[model samples]
Target: MALKQYMKTLSCPPGCNLLLDTSRFDNANSKLVDVLVNLKRIGQVSVPNTDENYAKIRQIIGNTINDPSVNKDLIIAAIMKTDAIRKRRGNSARNRSGLGDVFGGMDTGMDYGMDYEQYSKEKVTNKDFQANFTVDIEKEEKIFGDKSFGETLKDAEKLGAANNDITSIFPTAKTEEKSFEESCPKTDIHCAYVAYMENYANSLLNFKDFTQFDGKWMIARDKIAAALLHLKSSYKGKEVMQPNLDNFKNVCRKFVFLCGTKANRERSELVKSAIFIASEARADKDDLEIHLTDLFGEVKASPTISKDAAVQNRMLGADYADSVRITGSWRSLGIPSRVNGAESAIDYIREDNDVHSMHAAWHQINNQREPRDRKRERFFYFHNHMLLRIATERASNGLPAVQPMSNDVLHMEFSTEYNIRPENDPEGILDDYNSPPKTCRLTRNTQETLRNELRDLVRYKGLGMERFGHHCEQNYHADLHNLLMKDCDVGMLGYFAVSARPPIFYRIHSEINRVWHDFYSNQRYRRQDIYPPYGLTIRGITLHSRCGRVNQAETFWEKLGTHYKLNHQNFIFRIRLYNWRRLREKVIVRIFMGPQNARLENYFEMDRFVHQLDGNRLSEIRRYDKDSSFVFVKDQNDCGWPYHLMLPKGGDKRPIKYRLLVFVNDVHDQRVNVGTHPSLNNPMCGSNRQNMQNAGLELVDDRRDYGFPTNRRWTFNPVPIVNNRDRYFGYMSSIVNIVHTGEETDFCNQAYFR
Candidate 1:
């Protein structure tokens, strides 16, 4: 089934789309032939007789590029199958001779007996070469200024300037701009850089490097394969799959280091551009179009802006983010504004190494009273407030107010420091230390230290404490709160302004939650008033998909560039509630999806709503209702469900079963601020359309505990109870198929999501 799905995706052999014809293989260029051979070897597709083969090869190549995790055995099997087909057809091509001929045979082990030195002399000359690729940093610096391009763009924000004022800081925006393939300029730097880097990283696609046509290419391929396998086998969603240029650079950086290949200085230049381009592309809309050349200068991608689903999917979805990030950019469209460089100031502060450490020196002694130290502290403190502020605002916006980093990641800070060797064991058998002792060592108490600072930021004596007031009361005792909040295990959350990908962020937050749970479980609710008159009841529940009602759905692993992530179709719920009161009353509704046998604590909180039903009316909330049930799931957090684990792992024999539960309580009522925006009533439960626009930043508007309503220490029993827990309401059962490979077939598309 996986193979069939994969075959269906192929329009031509992977990497053969540039060549277009198998007869193109009848050439003097051994590099081209080697590429053809490698394609058949790795992809196992027969040489094409028609355009369909080109599509198939192109798709296969794309799949391999997006998922370097393709199994070697599978490739070997495909090659063997292709070889069998060739043998059945007779070895006509294999009998060819002379330097100008096609490969002698399809044998994987054969060298095809070509004089590579002669081939290089003939093909690599200036006259023979179609173009020359080089980075002119001097020209770039002269045109754009020596300052970091990102820093220059950021000046507009600092000056409180509008979008049009960008020219004041960057005069080059007004100058004549070059085409896509031209050298980097102030206006086109991001696109040029990304193009270069993408070309460098995906050098395998073009086979442009004649010197590496044989051995190094194969080695690089194997190393990438191994790296991808390692990443996927130990799959944790911690490493982001957003196709951000930095993420791509990081992945490529890892591969380059692990494969023992020091990228040529020229190649590194291209790699840098690739990173920038990929990032900008992923952040933009899918339909946004651009024209750009791949590294080989052979494949030109010009996606048409169209609404046709078939055309769009064929052109974009194969490696959507990957393709767009490289081919689509503001520069690609001839726009000069710094749309690609406009990352939040907070993001820059967190990601820049020097800035991160300078800000991290809050606990250090030397500069305890220095003005710079104070500034650093202010910076850190400001972001701490910002994170809590966003969380607070998100809570007010009816979205999840939990620090996104709460899932499973531990953000230990590390820095490369130099130390003199002790002169013991000079052979260097003890470590992979660079030089003597300059090594990337973990900062001592990195998490704990940051956590303490964060805790201080949240406390009464911290900066901007007045905004939180007494509402900052967590149920934990002061000492335990200090202990849990200051624990060093919280990496990204501890350093709130820094880069915190959601998965690991949630992990650290979960640990903190566990600590809080320990303290909360020990406390007792002294005043338990049984107000049966205020009893809230769930009237009925139904599962929904775009097509209509459905009880089962499938979640599958979808490839996104070099990574695989589980894709889920939006499943809606139509939940009915009865106030059972004659007077209008505001109540909190909690929804959970979990195993029937699991404890309420383990139940996944899917959605929450704060509703004021009309006097004694049954309020019906739909699945797409952000105010009542929906919070847009991004590449990272899914409100409550982690995308990778959206569906339970069921075998080929059966689907995983789960129970959906709904409960209502008045405990959250006192916590709600009256006259707050009616939209903020479900605080961090539902997000606005604006929030979706800035989803890349993963920003939210809420200031609340990571686990809000459920985190409360109070308990109450409701009518029509299902779980034995003190507060229970009702539940429904459902099942789903969990597969390794499948396309998004659900009604949820960009339109529904938007």
Candidate 2:
């Protein structure tokens, strides 16, 4: 009876003329199409316009004339079977719950309103509920020869009610070819590229906002294929490959813009990850291009060096026919040279070797002149080269080289310009002040000015704070607030505080860290704080989790989701401080976290607080929690980028060991009037700084540089640890392990009950 009911469900509903008298329609193909169209309209069959079956059915019905042998009933049965198979496939794959199970893999359970206790108590037994119904097409045609469609449908319903199984009529379900790539036949690279784009578009079907761009992607894919086909005729060797590859990259970059911008951060991050994967695919093609280029020589004959022109100008000091002989040359090497190197007339005098030297050599080879300001040029050059090296390395390693939509070639503007009105558009959507600046070629003089500005940024007291200071810090409170809150371009890295969104942020920091590493490796050997002059000491350090004490070999669960992550456990620090000062005095509680074996660059800023004390107290206890001055954890309202990364990934085998350092600074001497903005006072660190700033909220919590307590140059005499243990930068250390989340041994779980 159930099988008959399933078969009845596949057929058209009442008031269908095709079911009344099929003999009137001589063509079986036409009759089948009529039934299919009715079935499609009523939601029985879900055939999207893009489906090959939909097209095939349309073609057969529109073109077929008198096909005597073809059975329309069999075709209908096949369609029904295909639809069921697809439904089953999708149901099995879909993840209904964020917990990873769709429906607990059962027909009925607690999720579907069944009482868990009663259902569990009942004996689980397999019931033989199978049924089979047979359809007699000849008998049906004869019986309903002259019946009306409504009468025929009623008879079929009655037949369905009478039968138990309908295996003979429905046919077996089989895997249908639903993908466009399968239908299109990808025989070559062009077809493969087109298929890749189509697959990407198909993957975004779940996302409704991207629907408008789906058709555009198909059009672009076809356009790319056409362009490649046309170029194949005229271009020779690898030359043709270059243009097509570039075109594909351009298309990918164009699509990437749909993701980036001051758009919603959560959605944007998802789009970005997808675009990054697509861009990486294109970058892989670049490697193929390189291989092909190596296989084939240049498209044109190579040029030879000329000897006759400058033969008479052998003397270095003597003037030649071309008197000024200023043989000047200029070249562009992407933003690297344009921003901080020779193309921009900015140069750096190498202090110690880093990634920048490679770029300096590149500039020299290109015959570009260096900037006049030595110290300023060196700072810009080092940082510029450092960032450039990161991008180049990512490219070489087959990763996305820049932000998802960083291509300069394909730029688009809304037909109606978006205006950021502070009154109505508080998020600054129009001006996109949170976004990186869109700049054209900078003049040589402007480049020099930018260089000087960059130099000014890095010269700030602390290495880690240099970039933050120039962009958001150091500025007067009013000016900094304006820069952070307003819908202007001044908030971008080269210009503002919105550095974290772009990939260059990490690279620039890596360079800054490299500088610190060099300073520590060569200049300073001992990494402990030594202060014999001041009567202050780090009594002891303790790491506290929600449970009690954090020990080595602990495991913690990293909260993972489709678009977000959070560490299951949060920790607090308990620091014991001893003040040797007999009179009233204040000290800065500087805290940091680092790899047990690495340099200070890898160190994360934990917290910084100013502590005041009266006449000689031997010891003072200070407890720190997530509410402290430096911790930034993700929440429903705030978008903290990489805040989840603050907690290191845990291993199943052994607990992750980390070093905790606590050092103190005298409030009197260490005080620097780091100019402030509301951004300088927020505890949560994330990419949505501009979002908060535009809303006129604080972005960062601390007043000094981002890495305040340990940010300054560590030149103080080393402090001896009471026990034999590792030390760095004059800070007392404790080795602790972050336990895995939701573990049975973890006492933190008991908090839920309490």
- Choose the strongest candidate by lDDT: 2
How much lDDT does each candidate structure score? Answer: 0.32, 0.32
Candidate 2: where are CA atoms >4 Å away? 1-505, 512-533, 546-555, 558-564, 614-616, 633-646, 669-680, 683-731, 741-754
Please write out the lDDT profile of model 2 over residues 1-754, one tens digit for every residue. Answer: 2222332444332222122222332243243334443334333544543334543543343232113233333343333333333334342111222111221122221121122232334222112201001123222322222455456445434323223232211111122122323322232222333334334444544433322113332233333333332222111211111222333333332223222222443233233233322322231332222111111111111111112222433354423332222221111101112122221211111111111222222211111111111222233323332343343323322344333111121132201111223432222322433333333232344334434544554454355433432332222212222222222232423221122222334433443444333332324322333331265656667766665445332333221111112233555566665555553555556666655553443355555565555666466545544444433332211111122334443333334456777766554343321112222322222122332344454322223333433334445432243222423222367776654333224354432322
Candidate 1 local lDDT, 637-717, one digit each (tens): 112122233333222223345556655545344344211333232222232222234442222332333244334444543
Cα lDDT for residue 249, candidate 2: 36
**Candidate 1 ranges with C-alpha deviation above 4 Å:** 1-510, 524-535, 546-550, 558-564, 578-583, 616-619, 625-654, 666-709, 712-720, 724-741, 746-754
* lDDT of model 2 at position 226: 35
